[model samples]
Target chain A: MASLLKKLGSFAAGATLLFAASAALAKPLTVGFAQTGAESAWRTANTNSMKSEAEKRGINLKFADGQGKQENQIRAVRTFVTQGVDAIVLAPIVETGWEPVLREAKRAKIPVVIMDRKVQTSDESLYACFIGSDFYKEGAMAAEWIAKNAGSRSKIVELQGTPGSAAANERRKAFADELAKNPALKIIDSQSGDFRRSGGKEVMEAFLKKHGKDIEIVYAHNDDMALGAIQAIEEAGLKPGKDILIVSIDAIKEGVQAVVDGKINAVVECNPLFGPKIYDTIAKIKAGEPVERSSYNVDIVIDSTNAAALIGQRQY
Target chain B: MSKSKSLSPVWWPLIGLAVLVAVNLALNPAFLNVTVLDGRLYGLPIDILNQGARGLVLALGMTLVIATGGVDLSVGSVMAAAGALAAVLLAEGHGLAVALTAGLGVGLLAGAANGLLVARFGIQPIVATLILMVVGRGAAQLMTNGEVVVIKNDAFAFVGNGTVFGFPFAPLLAIALFVAAQLFLRRTASGLFIEAVGDNETAARFAGLGAARVKGLVYVICGLCAGLAGLMAAANIRAADSYRMGENMELDAIFAVVVGGTALTGGRFLLLGSFIGALLLQTLTTTMYNLGVPPAVAPVPKAVLILVVCLLQSEHARRWAVSLVKGGKK
Candidate 1:
């Protein structure tokens, strides 16, 4: 009878400890994600990264694909608000018409996190903050590299992205700004590639035909165009990395591999995996900590040295 | 037909091509420079031919389809889907033949679906093909799992990037297909039937021509050509970019056919004229890049080219121009 009572008391104590441990673990935060549809590989990688990060952090992510439409995003935001989510993450397809919906979320008192794109609002208090990769800085970095590594009196051929696009405009202006500081640097020919491999190749071929030996370097806006120009340069009997120094942005797998192989000189990183940082921001905002109006993702430059080590982690 | 009428629309595209080439020459005297480097013919003109090959292939089927009183808006999607399918197959270590067949087969199936709806069920060609167009893009995304499928295959890459007699195999394939199509339409009675069906559907039905079947067959042909285009595109890059590949190609093909002087309402089609039209479009693109034209307004030149070609081919413009020439003589 005494042994039975002692055993029962010990079991009760263990059960009490288990209950306390269970109570100590906090419930996972519920976040609703309104993603711009999978329009490209970069976007797909982004979506995957978000999903995996959410799972790792134990955040319940409510994902909604906007299919690259503004109206779809609006509807999605409304639905997330209805679900009473703790936080909302939006990767808007465009930069306009987000005010009305954002005001609604603000009225609901749900903290909203903007990802990948900016929303122009007269009122800054409508959302938490905007987090995205900086296009201007990426281009500026490329230009800085060129100004230092490129030989004096280098005739640069630029493969611009689609004209009028934010990426294209910002990258072009920032690159031009850097080149303005150096009298030896000159962009001989600049044309839009529409951000495609084929477009890049056609434009590069034309530049090769027109400029010939006058072109000593290529500054393509992206890796795909850089790769295409490399093909054109090879066809023209000019070595890309040797005769003409090549520089491009975006450290996608193929581009990084080329860097490791010595075909391309440098690539600037635009990290797509924003899940951990996104939720971290949410946690901070929820805890009443002050946050910046805009959070910029770090764009790291990769050359032959770090490219081999970093190639395995490339998602695209 | 009178000599001017016979030469009217045909010679105009040739004239446009000559003018563009001349412009390129004046802009850069090296435009005509050709060298045999690494056993392959390398030049600006060869690049134009190779780049124009996709448009050339698409225009061929589009010409036939328009001749049969049909228009296909799904060629772009089909091209994307075919490329995606080939990339998937090649990346999985499948044989080149199997991958090509599967890619082309998807094109055939998509075309057949378009055909069955239009020919068998009497649906509008545009609507039927549009259904496939939207679906094919989505399917392409699904097939590649929304990722780029890059293949490292030499044999498959040769289909897109290889050269024959120092000329790109893509253009050779396009030329061979163009000639074969031209002969098939001119030599065979089936060609006349297709033209008849396009000219007068009801009258042709009374004349016992299978209008639906002809319309269906043309869409299938369009699909097949789009499929081949997709394969070459994937092979060229050794990867399938479903989102980007074959994008806006359908419009380009339609533009090529229209610039070639084919009446959209249906009837006689021109192969060589369409070929020249394709060449003109590609050359204009090359010229724009060399001139350092912004990509945003680059299409302005192409739009202007189309406008000029269409106006020059129009009956009223032709009459006015001829009268002006006569007035000058007087």
Candidate 2:
């Protein structure tokens, strides 16, 4: 009995030491990534990048797909707070109605990192930082490239993305802003393609039949729409990549492939793959270093000059 | 069927389509222009035909299901599943035949499942089909892992974007399917059994007809038709987007079926009516687009149009209109 007691004492001391040792070194960061939803190819890439990036950095990621609903995102945030995660990452589906849920996370002292879309709240403390491509910049980048390449007086028809979507609205705004600088540039027609390949194709076909060769440039909000417009252009017996100067955003795989194939003239990168960049920010924040309030991922203006080389590295 | 009655159901939709076309012609004379370029027909009319082909194909199968006192709400989801399956199969280096078979097979099985639920399990057709309408889209998303699966195959591409004798093959295929469906019903006892079962199930069963088997068979055919439509849509765009490919297509198919004068209560079916109805809907949409109406409000006019068509199809409304016209003449 005495020997057993001695052994128990030593084991208790060892247990204490082990606990002390672990307490001395902070526990690995556990980030709860509350993804908006995998509604599109971009969303899929965003989710995939977060997951794989989390695995690479040894961070425990609690993922919840909100299925394109704000209510689902709010519920997932509540669950993450209850789980006592180190931090929370949110790719908001919409721009409003997040104050209450965000307050709950803030009350728990969990720093939130917003990605993809913005939260409408004015409070800067609601999130640790915003990490994504600047929509306004993405728009300007495409417009500048188009205006420079196609000359100022080119006839442009815009295939806008889904109406009321941030990407669509902001991109359209930036394009308008840039077009003002070039007085000769005229937008002959504009319509919403809903950011789908099929929509782009249908709308472009209508534009072709209506306007014919009057349309010199097709400004699609995203690559899918641009790709769809290419089909329409080809069916109309016109070369897409050259005959119609195609400028779109989001360097997705097929879009880049099209650029290489000489279908799309230029694509502005939105960089949906946020894994490595996100992890780097989290590491800095954890190390007691100040991070930027809004970190914009670098946007690239991809055209024939660099499209062929970058097609292999394209993530979304 | 008698020659006069054969085209009876077709005339209303045909007239409606012609009227819309005529209005478009007056507004924009370019709407009637058709030209053959490089062995393919190209024009606004042909574009409308291609656009309507997806819904027309679904309407073809939906007509049969509605004929048997059942509605398959799962047609749209089935289209997504078939498109995703075919896309994934082709992406995995499988032959076009394998992909087509597998895609159609998924559709048939999905339809069969709906049939079983309603026929064998005694569930309401709407509720039974609703289960698939919700779940099958998820199944499609899973098949593609929530990404648009883009593929390239010459033969498969030909099915969607190809032409037969210089007309778009998709519209032709829908017409062929409608004709085949019409012949199958008119030439065989299946049509009588279906009409009998739909009109009164217990009475038909008492009359020694297999009502459950008939309902199950129609649902299966409905699934197969949706599968073909899904394939055509995916092929048309050369990409299978499970999320958006067949999104809300069920409503379009149902609209075509209803506008074609197929009563929701079920008894008789009309194949050509659905075809013309599909064409009518497509023509209206093209007109709206050509007129530069915002797409958000595009559905508003369609809603009004369908309401008018429904009201016009009612016996009381038809009798009232006829009486008023005759009284004026007197």
Candidate 3:
């Protein structure tokens, strides 16, 4: 009986040793996701996607909502670094003032992924991959559509997004670059709509009063502004799509629906639903697989031609 | 001539507003035309009118509250709560009259809670109202499950979107409220009592002015203004997005009141000045947009303009300017 007990004890010790070895080999990946506030439906959807995808992949996602404050976001990043997260994802509030914190992340040897918004850091090597719709390209696409639909002689009024945001900057740059291709396409007046419905409306109203019938096209950086501009246009006793062509980025459901209603002329899709792709990218990096530095492409445009068909599938 | 020499505080703000308008016109000649009025008056510009109307109403109530040596930061949040409640009830197919009545009732209840906390418990007005300011938005968000409730009732819509004699109903409603408040303050003993309590609370208390009761009444009045503002906002957009409803409105309202020549330190009230202040802010924003300035950059000019106005109004600034002029002459 003593000899039998000795044999069982040795067997138990061998099993424990093997378990320890496997445990040492398999390390859990800790991912920190700093999100912008759930200010809009698109932001909420983006957050949910990231969370659900993280859960499915068995990655620990440490989440923080910035509440539209840059300071809060910077603090969250510092907290993530102190907690020794394996990877980090940032959806920045603005384009500047991130180089120092990003350098800290680099020193900590954690891979960083820029989720939706891009930052204006001089160093490009600090992040692993940027996963977002190309805002500049999206803006140019909207402008191109307007140029094609409205012809070269149209007098355009631009409705810009949030002042210092990458989306706003890139969209404006790209739109201007495209419009520069057509000299006759004069941008009569431009103003910051602040990426809000009311901001868009107020600016549009002022634009209408200043330009009157000479105003041909209304180009907004986002759908909300476009929608707001449409209200202003209609309120002035002018047909929105017929009299003043409205084109905007962010093919959110409302924008697409507006296209269907013939209230807006065109909508350039800026897909906010980027969840599964982000999770897979993080997993690939963890497994020592080669991942592209910039992976996603902007969505296709939706206009009156395809508005009815695509409105049903539009999400945010 | 002697009475005219004793300049009313209202004239100061009015003069400042006129000078600012002149500056804007000088900077951009197209700013003064009525043709640009149509587009600017629709969404964002119109929303400003909406905000101004609401701010005027709240400031009118706040004027009373401040007169009683009290402050109410929760007016914006109360507006949100009222909007949320109204939106939810309306979404549930409740009668327009019923929903509006319930909204006002809720506002009164919220005000009463604030009043009771401050008056009955002897809590500081700022502290008492702060509690609601922080939690009221959360309550509003929770009420609508954080969803934007799109209202469809035309009767409810009329209050927000409809026009009266070619004038937007909201601005008109605000004007009506301002006139009523002006009448109340200028022609009533209750207004005098409020100002008396604010000027010297202990003295007013000693004089048997029922200072606590007067203080409580202002909070209720402030809540009612917020309720009305919420109704107008919900109607104009045909939706209630609690997330952004009346966001940072308290700051704007306080700024309007302060810029209107109502002392932040608390003493006198100016109904017309507050109204004009609201209009000034909206016009400034509209003008900035019209002048081809980027939206983000608008805040910079606005900040500078406000600083200039405030500095001009400061006694130290006024003295310095006068001395500089005298020195220049010498």
Candidate 4:
């Protein structure tokens, strides 16, 4: 028993010395972030925020811009895997084609934190936590604002974002769900604006030509489209906020400005500032603390009344 | 002597444009409009002009390249590189003239690289430009470290978004380039040499024309056009997102050239036809979006329209349609 105690004491001292040495030589956490390309101002800001936050935290961030291509993103993720990063952050371009790659990350025991966008995988174990605005809630907020302001009987035109995108899919589904509650609230015309200002304007112009007086409201998936729709409405000799009420997601500064200027009636904010929250999660995971598998409910609705005040504080 | 039974290429694309316009007008009469013109100059019609301007500029240079029996797939990458360079320079507080000059110079250098590879090494133009197409974007991305460089200079902004006598500067630039190219090609011996080289490089060389020099210069001109278009696009948005800079632009330029009645196999060039083709393409996209088609589904109608136009332009398809009409009448 005495000999066992002596061995135990020596082992304890050895472990203590090893721990002290490790603490002394502790390197900054290395993170691999595979970002979707700067397709929008929000995306650009997201990337900048990540880099700045990483710098502030003294974490080594190995970054890759996927340029909105799936193949490039896959390659980036595999590269991160090969680099043996402690954790991986992916702002996925699309949702469906991620299972195989994510499985690979899981096999490697690398914790993945999904940022800004969500993946549609059946296995929840593949990712640690998804940090993003609830896209469905955002879409529903836009729909609810439209219903309240434009009346249930108002005819609406929807300008969707890119097809097959998780945000676009969820936003569309949620808006459709909300619209189902009010039978008189009909979508007379709907088109994909491809999440671009020019695309939105072009489509809105077509909607104006085809639907004419039928379109009483424009429910855009994002503010850029709403802004474009406003231009189309104005060009068609109709007042945008007055004649055709507009509600959209993504309360970007320009979108807020549009609301304040009375061009768009309301905007549902999909907060692009996920840096602080993401860094906190990463730190928590590194410390072997419990982290939620899903982070939900990060969205706000800004309207004409509050738009002016919030525009100054808006980051993206 | 019997006239050569060659097809008049211009006849087909014009007919196709006419049919598309007719269909669009029939579907929605508001499509045919100049009413809002100057009043809502930043409206949907203006957006169409913006999208077409880049394609128009690229097509102009592509016309010369195609006339020399060569293709430059690197035009899009060249645009990205130029935009990246301009953004970096402007971000560093360089003067507008210096930034513009440097941007053009970079474009010229990239073009020269393509010209050298093709002229000196006798590499296939497609293969030569393809290498740059893949790597040039990477170089541009590297220049910005894959970050967007937003600019706030009013003078530079005017080049893209500013209005000149109530017209957007981009379209104006495109028109100016078109006019210059028209004058150069119609009234110059260089134009004849280009045609000669495209028609038969051996014959042109035998006739004492400097075929290599003409070919090299055409690519340089193509590069300049792409570079200018890139600068305009970056300035218009007041930001340079390298990833999206000139993405898939080469396809649009090629489509414009093909739809403009420029033969893909080379020989002849058409400045007016290419401009019109660009305009028509933009108009079609704008019209389709306006017609309540979902964004995901917008490409479908565009593809269908292109197919219809292609079929209508084909002598075989036209002959088939005529025979069916005749049989029905009998």
Per-residue lDDT of candidate 4, residues A1-316 (tens digit): 9999999999999999988986788867889999988656778778888998999988899999998898899899988988899999999988778988999999999999998777899999889999887888888888888778775447887888889777899999999999999777888877887776655766786677566678888888887677767766775678988888888888878778888899888889888777778989999998999988788647778997788788898766
- Against the native complex, each candidate's DockQ, computed on alpha carbons, is 0.58, 0.50, 0.32, 0.29
- Against the correct fold, how does model 1 do in TM-score? 0.94
| Prediction 4 TM-score vs. true | 0.80
- Which residue runs does candidate 2 get wrong by more than 4 Å? A1-21, A121-129, A280-295, B1-9, B316-330
What's the C-alpha lDDT at position A15 in model 3? 97
Docking class of 2: medium
- What's the TM for model 2? 0.92
Clashes of each: 0, 1, 11, 4
User: Model 2, A115: alpha-carbon shift in Å?
Assistant: 2.3
- What is the iRMSD in Å for candidate 3? 4.2
Model 3 stretches with alpha carbons more than 4 Å out: A1-32, A55-62, A66-88, A92-110, A119-127, B1-5, B20-51, B121-127, B145-147, B290-297, B311-320, B323-327
Models sorted by TM-score, best on top: 1, 2, 3, 4
> lDDT of each prediction vs. the true structure?
0.87, 0.87, 0.79, 0.80
Quality class of the docking in candidate 3, CAPRI style:
acceptable
Residue pairs clashing, model 4 = A192-B294, A192-B295, A206-B290, A207-B290
- Model 1, A207-241: lDDT tens digits are 88788789888998888888878878887888878
Each candidate's B-chain TM-score, in sequence, is 0.96, 0.94, 0.90, 0.91
- Output the number of the DockQ-best candidate: 1
* Residue A205 of model 1, lDDT score: 84
